[model samples]
Target: MDVPIKATPKQFYDVFCNKTHYVSNVCPDKVKSVVLQEGNWGTEGSIISWTYAF
Candidate 1:
C-alpha cells in the first residue's frame, strides 16, 4: 500500500525512530497500542511490543 503524506522523508523517519510509542495514534485502526517491553525507547537493544487492532 502506498499512502502519501505531507511530511518529508526525514520527518517520517523521525516518527518511527524517535517517536515509536506514538505510532498507534497515527494509525489507530491498524495498531491498537505500542508498549516498551524492555530497555528504553529509541535505545539500542530495546524491545517493544505491539498490539494490532486486526
Candidate 2:
C-alpha cells in the first residue's frame, strides 16, 4: 500500500480534539465508548485513553 495520503491542518486538529480516527481506525468488532468525567468539551491537560478488545 504505497498510497500517498495526507491530512489537512483542520483534520489533524479534529482528531486531536475528538478521537474520530481512533474509533474509525479500530476493527469493526471492537467495543467503544466515551465517558464524560467533568470535561467532555476538552480542556487544558485533559486525558483521553482508549482500550480495544474482541
Number of the top candidate by lDDT?
1
Candidate with best TM-score: 1
lDDT of each prediction vs. the true structure?
0.89, 0.53
Error of 2 at 13 (Å): 3.6
Can you give the lDDT of residue 33 in candidate 2? 42
The total of clashing pairs for model 2 equals: 0
- Model 1 ranges off by over 4 Å: none
Residue 38 displacement (Å), model 1 = 1.4
TM-score, one value per model: 0.84, 0.34
Tens digit per residue, CA lDDT, model 2, 1-54: 353437787876776576543543543356364444444545655555555565
